[model samples]
Target: MPSSLTPPPVQASFGDTDVYLFREGTHAQLYRRLGAQLSPGGEGASFGVWAPNATEVAVIGDWNHWSDLADPMRARADGSGIWQAHCPSARHGQAYKYRIRTRNGDVLEKADPFAFLAEEPPATASRIWTLEYDWQDAHWMGTRGAANALDAPMSTYEVHAGSWRRKDGQFMNYRELAHALADYVAGLGFTHVELMPVTEHPFYGSWGYQTTGYFAPTARYGTPQDFMYFVDHLHQRGIGVLLDWVPSHFPTDAHGLAHFDGTQLYEHADPRQGFHPEWNSAIFNYGRHEVRSFLISSALFWLDHYHLDGLRVDAVASMLYLDYARKHGEWIPNVHGGRENLEAIDFLQELNRACYRDHPDTFTVAEESTAWPKVSRPIEMGGLGFGLKWNMGWMHDTLAYMREETVHRRWHHDRITFSMVYAFHENFVLPLSHDEVVYGKGSLINKMPGDSWQQFANLRLMLAYMWAHPGKKLLFMGGEFAQRREWTHEGELEWWMTDQPEHRGMQLLVGELNKQLRGEAALHQLDFDEAGFEWVDANDRDNSVLAFLRKSRDGQAVLVVCNLTPVPRQNHCLGVPLSGTWREILNSDAKPFGGSGWGNLGEVRTAPLAANGHRHALYLTLPPLSTLYLKRDADV
Candidate 1:
């Protein structure tokens, strides 16, 4: 090949505004400019990369027989430290990498950080590809704002695509998973589906958490268009898609961002500030302006290109505190001599701001397991500016309370009741996520303390309690059907378990709970406000019974009562806001849900006698180890 085939560096196709904003750390659309982009009519491609410390850079790919001297890139004279070149022979679907000569004369070949598609893992080369998909969810895109609103009933089904289902011991393609997942989620009445990270990673065992290609979806499933179809299929079925995004840390793989250009260009030089001991990963240098732009741009790219409804940021607590998972003196303090990660905090605030500003119809959630105040509050109000936050405290306390024997549950009643004191502190999502059912923690069903029958009942009761509580809901895969084994990425869920009566009953109960949550305004409309919840009897320790009212803004209400022990309580008097017939909307102890056929006979009337501080009260049967939802008959 003649040397003239490699043209001299020209001005980037993207404008100078992108460069200015990138340097200022405010660029949210760098994907359009910095990555390998196909030229018009697919004649060739334009390549751009940022490697300020590189002494020389060249594009080596299949088009040029992987020759390092074939297409040498030229550095821009604008002092932006960007190298660019045009290769007319570089067509789509060609594997490529940048060979960089470090300042100290060492050479390194790195995958494109902003690649839209990567060669399937076990092969670390980036592929030249185009993102072109004809989306068919115009109706979903037009009105998703209301469906994703705070008051809307949001129940998320967390899934791992590779393990969600496999065909003949092989991973299902994105298109196949899309149809199967959409059918399953819509049938369960869940409003949204939260996918674990799909970003490219060399290790399948990481489950996509140790992400490398920020802008590319893993090719293990399919192409970028395939992933787009997955989202489009879900949206068309009225199920929103939320991606679990990891901006906290990345793996220290040799082919990843650990050391680019023979230096820690993307990470801090100091081990104390750059390393994550717990995850065995390298933390990004959030203090760098270019790094901020890169992270934020990755976040926006997903929502913009994939038509995703929201994002659930992962490991936020690790980003918020410098001392996270580190022993004394093992971590470095911020400039203020505090343990807080000030640079990371600023990056998070900016990320949320940019996400909301660009996609106001969408939302962002934080999996923050700390007492960080105002995590879901507005940025202007001295907050982190997230739309929702995972309720880790609630998950831990509730599980702890449930694991105790019925006879001992009264002593630990506060564990179940304490969450209400801080429930309204932030917009919360009561997540029984994958983290709860792994590493010998046991499946959610096995966590209960009881015989086979009692275990099933306890599982149903716990799920009912989560639905009736004040917050949005999220349940990991297999938990809905009471899978007895712990979750693992290596295998698909036990789908055959649903054939059993007890297991199928649990599935039916979850579907019913979701239906009730969406059908009744009181169950979800005021999930984040104190006024939506009222304690009818929170201190019934001796009986191990608790009752509360979930009210809507329009005065509609649902009365929820839970009996912790396996001892049935007949004629359990509970207060009612209305003086009329109260209908038993749902009963976990009903025969259909693998429980003894014990409950109030459909409905009960409230008498004039006052109880639990109400003008009228109802004496109803509360089943053993069950939760009941009652709503007053509007006709009465």
Candidate 2:
């Protein structure tokens, strides 16, 4: 293929204005002018890169038989470190790399930092490409602002595209996966699918976290246009797409951004500041104006070109704290002797601000696993300005309590109820993410402590409790059903397990939970407000029972009750604010969910008996290892 989609040879260069804006770190649309663009005269492609430390830079590819000096590039007049060259011989399908002669007299070939497509791993060559997909999701785009509002109902299904499904032992391409994934997620009633990092990476085992090409989607799945089709198809099915973005660190591959231009240009000079000891990656130099411009531009590229709905930032905790995952004498403190990475703080704030500015309806979530204050608050109020933060504390506490034997669960009652102490500290998403089910941690279902039957019951109860808890919800794929094995990036999920009744029951429970969450305002309308939640009976540790009420801004309310132990509680009295009939809106112990069917027949009449600080009370049967959702009769 030709290096571009144009007609003939023309001058390919970045103007002085482009250099100035890039130097000032204000060029959010740098992709427009940088990288390989079709020539205006319609002949070939314009290749550009930033390599100030290089004595000479040339475009090398199959078109020139990989000759280093076949296509020499010119440096910009401005001192912005940009180089450009027009390759009339380079076509759309041609592979290319920048051959740079470093000041040290070493010639190195590096992949284009702005390449739209790249050859699959084991071959590190940038491809001259163009994206031209006709999107048919205008309705989804126009209405997404309201659909993705903070107060809206959001049940995200976090998925790793490569492992979700496969055919003939091979990964499904983006177009094929789109049709199947959209139908499956939509049928399960998930409002959105949060994909694990889909950025291009050399090592598939990293699960796309160690990105090499920030602007390009992984070719393992499909072409860039095909990934766009994946997003568009989901949009048409009324499902939003949230991509996992890793701006915190990048892999140390030779052709990657590690030592671009034969210097510490993208990362810091010192290992303590730039190197990630745990992951063996390089932390980006967030303070550098040009590097900041690069990262911000990458984020904008996805939203602008791909029409993505949101970005879920990864490893935010590591980015925020300079001492994260480090021992004594292994890290440096800020000027104030604090652990905070001041530069990263500024970058994240600016990132969130720019994202919202460019796309008002889109959101950014922080995968920060710390007690960082105001992580989801507005930047104007001295906060990091993220739309949401993963509720790591809730996930940890709930999982710890659930893993305990049912007989001993009463002793750990506080673990289950302690999350409400600071539930509203920031906007939160109760996430049972991919991290929970990998690296020998066991699958979500396997984490439960009980016999086979009780394990399924416990899994259903945990999910019910998670949905009814005071936050938005996120569950990793295969968690909807009771998959018994931990997740592996190399293989597909155990989809065949769903044929079993117990597994199918868990899937049904999740589907119903999503439906109820969307239909009930009390479940989602005021999730971030303390006033929306009230304790009905949080002090029943002796019976291993807990009850609470979720309220909308309006008068509507739904009561949630849970029995963590296998011993059922009979004639359980829970106070109700309303005097009308309260029906069993959902019972995890119902027969359909493969439970013992120990629940109220249908509804319970609220009696005018003073209990648990309310004038009216309802007597009901609480099933073993189950959660129940009750709603008041609207007709009363």
Per-residue lDDT tens digits of candidate 1, residues 387-432? 9999999999999999999999999999999999999999999999
User: For residues 172-266, what per-residue lDDT tens digits would candidate 2 score against the true structure?
Assistant: 99999999999999999999999999989999899999999998998888789999999999999999999999999999898988788889989
Clash pairs of candidate 1? none
Best by lDDT: 1
Candidate 1 global lDDT = 0.93
RMSD of each: 1.6, 3.0
Which numbered prediction scores highest in TM-score against the true structure?
1
* Cα lDDT listed for each candidate: 0.93, 0.91
Candidate 1 — number of clashing residue pairs?
A: 0
* TM-scores of the candidates in the order shown: 0.98, 0.97
